[model samples]
Target chain A: MSARDDILGSVRRSLRRDRLSDEAQAALQRRIRAHERNIVPQRGSGSGAEIAARFIDEAKSVAVTVQPVASDAEVPDAIVRYLAQHNLPARVAMAPSAALEQIPWASRPTLEVRRGAARPDDQVSVTPAFAGIAETGTLMLTSGAETPTTLNLLPYDHVVVMRTSQIVGSYEDAWDLLRQSRSRADGLIDMPRTVNFITGPSRTGDIEQKILMGAHGPRRLHIVLIEDA
Target chain B: MESTSHRFKENAREGMANPSLQRAMENMRRGFPDKRLAAIGRLPEFDALRDRARDIKNHVLEHLDFYLEAWEAKVTAAGGHVHWCRDAEEARRTVLAICRRLEARTVTKGKSMIAEEIALNPFLEANGIEPIETDLGEYIIQIRNEPPSHIIAPAIHLTQDDIEKSFRASHRQLDPGRPLSEPHQLLDEARSLLRDKFIAADVGITGANFLIAETGSSVIVTNEGNGDLTQTLTKAHIVVTSLEKVVPTLEDAQTILRVLARSATGQDYSVYTTVSTGPRRPEDLDGPGEYHVVLLDNGRSRMLGTEFHDMLRCIRCGACMNHCPVYATVGGHAYGWVYPGPMGAVLTPSLIGVDEAGHLPNASTFCGKCESVCPMRIPLPRMMRHWREREFERHLSPAASRYGLGLWAFLAKRPRLYRLVNGLMARVLGLLGREHGGFRHLPLAGGWTGGRDMPAPEGEGFHQAWARKRRERTRAA
Candidate 1:
């Protein structure tokens, strides 16, 4: 047997010999069955930008800037311009996506774009969202070629770009999408393994429930809702 | 107070007598479960998420060795060291050795359950190293020379008035005449007192919520910025976490985080979720110089390949305790361990051995409120039963109880004998309790009858009454 199979075999054996009552064993099986049933298909459709706007409005209670992208090349220029307009530092963290890298920044001397890695002092980081849930204004970030988890968390400010088609109505719809995607993929559903649903910037009420922004993570969260990108 | 069992009884007695603690517990009993249900009610997919989370945890446990090695590689690549400890003693000794090597005189600590498991504070003090708890709740308990009663709300047992007195006594440098009544005033005093310790401490220790194997990072989510301050401002940063905290990716961590705060305190997300990849990079102006991640096995690894593997899925949300009827009445300290409530009942026995903590499992009313609210869906009652089974197998139970149970089980299995015995007992009880239809005293059942009267059987047993009713119906037809 393969190494994985060997280990699993031993686990199965050990579980069978365990001293649990028959009723307990049956109850556990039932719970597992119920869990399996939840992974089935569901129907939902919504616009990512509308979801993004609603989330940004509800979660942050602040004005948001929605940017539309025509070509991949314009992405970097748009980011640089936005940063420059805000008078932010030149360094920007970009997600590990082919589309993110396609942004032509060779001519922009002032802009220094780096690959997604956590640095203590990076001013702003940009990443693409795997999906966006309109229900709670949550950006569902998954680790893969398109988005790196580090870029979303490390910088002082985080800017997430969501395509309009990737929006879902609720968390259940999100799970259905994930389940379908994993079923289609080969070799045990290599799902990004980690999916982060970010609603707002890092905050703390620890110091006597006094609201403190940017306690340990990012201070500001900016969502760039892209339409027809 | 030698063993946990002894300390547990003492703490329980003290907690039961403390009126303020009783009041606080009553507030918690009403607040937490209601908020959690409301939070869960909003999300139809919460059940699905919990299932997914349980599966994710199971998958991790199944492949823990591979993942741990993978995580170690990532952490080492990111300029972090991962140390594997087999038990609490080893973990404490390793941590102390690290401090001794650095000649660390003062240490600042973020809230860590593993540190409590190892009894790290006392060990540090014995070694002449001063350790300060930075979390407000932990700091209060530290001043009072007590272990945390609750996992999240460590000093929940202490009232504001109690805190005022403790603050006045402890903050000697402050003006003796000033009135310290307000909550904010006490917080400000604590902040000022803890600020210098945060800045001056040589070593900072924390606990990990999730360890990213791919990135070699330790992630912590807290409301108070204390965790970040403790890690960033110190010269050395140490994270003590159980082996099960490792997750494969940040997305997985987020999925867990989504449930964590909602289960913990009804918040969608905690105030701060910090991910520390390594020590400060060369370009960084401020951060820890040396970063260490201590992965403690502490019976957890053995649990990975056992039936208790599901217990590893726990995120330490303490929902089970908040909703548990027994826990709400007695509070966490009554369990007499670092972990308490239903989760504690199962885990303490597993970690400390069933023989030592057999009473913990039996302390529950088995109402199943704990299982229903548990975000991880750990079958807490079933696990408690497992502990009971282990205790029985070892012949650790009292002889009188064992004999009673054995006889009862035998009679229960045989319906004829059970009915005959129960019928006779019921008639006797009815005759004795005709005055009030109840009894205040019963042989070998004083433990139950002591606090409240046992209602006598109304008439014949259910089976006998049913038979008589059927005979009368036949005669009428």
Candidate 2:
């Protein structure tokens, strides 16, 4: 027998059963399909403004800098000001998503914006997040043609552009959004190749249990939160 | 990987005497538990979530074969391959075959206890594949040629000076005078040094925190982004995880994640939780072109339906060890395997046999702190007792312990004789130690009295005192 059959057979013998009956399999399938939420924390549940506020506060507490902009047009200026404030280079490896294309990068002529996956030498990256999780101040980014997963890593600095409308109260809410957004006509969930829930800049407490930021990933995580979506 | 576990007493003695290891453990005891308390304090639903997490795992374990088959179908549909390995050797062979097929020279790895269990690095190096550990803690220990001292914090046994010395010796090309004073400077050096390896590696190997059977995705939770970089930059990505990691759906994964980081590092959430479903799509700009999942059993399947079955609920949070008195004192290395602490005490014997790893179960104090703090609520103390019972039943326990237990059983069954002998001994010891109120040395209890004086018994034994107290209470009533 193959290793798969041998292992599965052993599991069945240990579990005291052969292949599960049809009724049992159906019940298991139903549980997975239901995708029920268990004990969603009360902390992140609130109105739109309240949820967005909590998201910002939670993000800030974890050492991520959050800037609330009034509109999409303000994003370019926000990025430019943030770069200048931090003394970072004006060059950015921006994700070429349709939502990000709405921003007026031309207004910031001094900035060198390269729209593609981040390169090995890229110092900074700017990507539009799919959603902001209010519970833990996490940004949800999915891999796709326009948004390469590399931009989320490899770079020393990561600047995420998100809107208040994209903020969700919990991780369960984010999963619901993902399922609804990616549901196919055949009733299957076309899950993304990769989904990253990044809460803060990369850090490690490996050496003497001392926390240090920028360990093999972005050191600085700056969020440009658009207030008026 | 090698079992020095039979010499646990000596290993623990060495561990306790090592000043640097003691200092490092002191820092960990001060840091991890308090942070976990604060993190859990912020969420009112934390305990409720733990219960939900435990139930979800229980449900999956009962129907594990069903879930694995379902998960295999999802992975196949997503264009990913799943390999089933019965033990460590097959697991290693499967991984090496994939790497060889990809023509991989150098592979970058994220921190994985499973990788340590299989001893993948040595196997790969022997096969001419250079495996570079990407997690900072793993990198530090890997260069020093040591196994992870702690599951989450691999270099928790080392001091900052040790790391600086290791870096100086390994990265000899760099300037010798460069300041490595602060932790950030070390981080910067490692970041720059590893950046090239991440970009140039042919394959990336990582362990899964949870495998979502619903989406056929492997989830990796880490503080550093090395896991992301490892999977994204390499041409092929391989997940080497065990059977128990699989959960039924994304929601199930979320329920467990809610408690994972808070228990592990006291964070509301880890810095990065990345879920990878399969290989990169045709439209994708950058990701691993090939993806494979290796499911390892390694005696775990046999653990099912046994007394040790509850050990499968472990999330590798390190909370049990963080709060374990034995772990806090002797640190992780003394348990002498890939796992350590309360969890390791119960698990080591099951994986490595009761004879070889029997001493680990005897190392616990059974204070019940581990079970109280366990997010999965595994009855860790009870499980350790079970291992002890198994050892005794198999005659794997030492001759002295067996003789001691035989005497105990004999005395315990004869209550009248036991109380009579106890009273006589108490009276004699009480009179003999009237001056000091304790014995400086004893005949048979040299091990107990070696470190400190053993307190003498009171004038009256426990039975006499209890009988007098009861009579007084009856008279008062």
Candidate 3:
């Protein structure tokens, strides 16, 4: 017998069942299809503005820098200012998302921005988030031609622009949004190649349990929150 | 991978004596439990979530075969492959096949204990392939040529000075005077040294925190994001994980994730929780072109429906060890295997065999802290007791202990003789210890009184004291 059959057979013997009954199979299928939620925390529940405020506060608590701006047009200016303040280069590897491309980057002629996936040579990368979860101060990013997962990982400085309206109260809300998009009437979520939930800058407590940031990922995570846009 | 579990007593003595190991163990004992308490303190529903997490795992284990089959179909549908490996040798061979097929000369690996279980690094090096461990902790141990003493904090056994010495010796190309004194500097050095490896490795291997059947997703819970870099930059991504990690859906994954990070590191959530569905999609700009899941069943299926079946619910959180008194003193390496602590004590016997690892189950103080902190609510002490019983049944216990238990059992059955002997012994000990009230040493209990004194029995036997009290009460009435 194949290793698969041998192992499964052992499991069946141990479980004292030759095979799954029809009722058991049907119940499991229903649970998978329903994808029911269990005991989601109440910490993320509030009004939109309140949730956004909580997002900023919670994000800051986890060592994330959040800058709430008035419009999408100010995002370029905000990035420019943040880079200048940190004494970084005025360059970015911007994602090829339409939402990011529509930003008025032409207004800032001095800034050098390239649109593509992250490069080893790229010092900074700006990627648009699919959603912001306020409960844990997390940014949910999807992989695609536009988002291209590397932007969130390879850059030294990562600047994410998330609209206040896109910020939800919990991970459940974000997952629900993902499930609703492109479902084939079977309640199955057509997940992207990858969905990354990033809470803060990359860190490690490996060395004698001392937390050191910038370990093989971004050193600084700056969120340019577009509020009242 | 060799069993030093039989030499646990000696290993524990050395572990406690080493200044560096003691210092590291002290830090864990002081920090982790308090941090877990504070993290859970903020969430009122933390205990309820643990219950839900237990139910979810119990459901999965009951229908493990069905879930694994369903998950394999979904993985194949998503343009990936699943290899069923019965043991460590098969798992190693399967990984080698994938690497040879890809012509992989350099393999970048994330932190996976399954790799440790198979002893993959040496096997790869012998086969003329270089395997670079990318997690900061794993990298530290890799340089030092040591197995991880702790699962999560692989380098916790080493002091900062130790790391500085290893870095200087390993990275000879870097300037010797680069002020590599601080943890941040050490981290920066590793980050730069490994960035090129991420780009250069032909294949990347990682362990899954959870494998979802609904969307064919393998979730990685990390704080440093090196696993993401290791997988995303490689041409092919291979997941070296076990069968018990499979969950039924994304929602079930979320339920476990809610409790996992909090229990492990006192974090509300790990920094990066990435769920990979398959290889890079057609429209995706960058990701691995190939994806493979090696589902290892190394002795886990046989453990099902036994006294030790609940051991499969382990999420590798490291909390049980964090709160285990035996672990706090001996550290992880003394358990002498891939796993350690209360979980290891129970699991090692079942996986390796009680005869080889019988001492591990006997190393516990039965403080019940491990069970109290366990997110999956595994009865760790109860399972350890089961191992002891199995050892006794097999005549694997020491002759002295067997004879002692035999004597006690014989005496316990005769109540009249038991009380008479007990009264005589208590009177003798009471007279002997009247001056000091304790004994510094004893005849057969040298192991017990080797380090400390044993308190003497007080006054009369229990039956005599009860009778005297009853007569005095009657006279007063």
The most accurate candidate by TM-score is 2
Identify the leading candidate in terms of DockQ: 2
**Model 3 spans with C-alpha error above 4 angstroms:** B434-437, B460-477
Model 1 has a DockQ score of 0.09
Candidate no. 3 TM-score:
0.97
On DockQ, the stronger of 2 and 3 is 2
User: Which segments of model 2 are wrong by more than 4 Å?
Assistant: B451-453, B475-477
Better structure of 1 and 3 per lDDT? 3
Error of 3 at B470 (Å): 6.8
Candidate 1 i-RMS (Å)? 8.8
Writing each residue's lDDT as its tens digit, candidate 3 over B304-376 gives 8999998999999999999888888888989988788888899888878888899999988898988998989
Q: State the number of backbone clashes in model 2.
A: 0
TM-score of each: 0.74, 0.99, 0.97
Instruction: Compute the lDDT for candidate 3.
Output: 0.89
Per-residue lDDT of candidate 2, residues A7-123 (tens digit) = 999999999998999998999888888878778889869998888889999999999999988998898999999998988899999999999999989988999999999998898
Q: Summarize candidate 2's per-residue lDDT along B1-477 as a digit string, tens digits.
A: 787788888889999999999999999999999999999999989999999999999998999999999998999899999999999999999999999999999999998889999999999999999999999999999999988889999999999988999999999999999999788888899999999999889999999999888889999999999999999999999999999999998888998999999999999999999999999999999899999999999999999999999999999999999999999899899989999999988888889888888989888878999999999999999999998898889888768768887997898899999999889989999888888999999887777687679788887799999999999999999
Interface Cα RMSD for all candidates?
Answer: 8.8, 0.7, 0.8
lDDT per residue (tens digit) for residues B286-313 in model 1? 5677889877877775576565778999
